[model samples]
Target: MEALVAITIGTLTAVGLYLTLRLRSFPVILGLTMLSYAVNVFLFASGRLVQNQAPIIGSGETYADPLPQALVLTAIVISFGMTAVIMIMAIGGFLESGHDRVNMAASDPADADQDDAEEGWA
Candidate 1:
């Protein structure tokens, strides 16, 4: 069980990093989300993996730590808000620039001039 959780976290982290290196805004946002999910899973696993155990401590019985669970919950909420904000920013950027790239290079003067001409700002 622990191995499975570990593998899952590792896989998520790997995929997230791969996607994060992409040039497009949407993939970057998705990568960040996956990274957050990996972090949440890791944090949750830190509380132990005992089955059939309650979060509350009881007399002579094993209880999973609730702190990690609480932290994961908080992280989930924060990540959701962050994802929403990033998506909105991406959309706005796309609308303004006509591209979904996060880091556009300024190496092409012709393209720049064309864009300026199209926008009537040349």
Candidate 2:
């Protein structure tokens, strides 16, 4: 069970990092989302993996730590908000630039004038 969780976290982190390095906005967003999921899972797993265990302390039986659960919950909310903000920013950037690429070409004034002349605009 622990091994499975570890593998899941590793896979998520690897995929997230891979997508984060992409030159497009959509994939970068996905990568960040994946990274957040990985973090949430890791935080949740830190509490405990035991079944039928309550989170309350001072009990006779084994109790799981509630801190991790709370942390995971908070992380989920934060990640959601973060994703939404990034999405809005990406949309705005796309609308302004007509593309969602991260690596935009350097628009020098000289180059613009040369292109305009070539196109018979000037």
Best by TM-score: 1
Model 1 lDDT tens row, 6-121: 99999999999999999999999999999999999999998888787778878337988889989999999999999999999999988977888777577644244565555745
Q: What TM-score would every model get versus the actual structure? A: 0.85, 0.83
Best model per lDDT? 1
| Poorest 10 consecutive residues by lDDT, candidate 1 | 108-117
Pairing residues by index, what is the TM-score of model 2? 0.83
Query: In candidate 2, residue 34 scores what lDDT?
Result: 97
Pull out the clashing pairs in model 1: none
Over the full model, what C-alpha lDDT does candidate 1 score relative to the true structure?
A: 0.88
Count the clashes in each prediction. 0, 0
Query: Per-residue lDDT for 1-122 in model 2, tens only?
Result: 99999999999999999999999999999999999999999998887687777788877478888899989889999999999999999999889767888775667332234455556453
Error of 1 at 77 (Å): 0.3
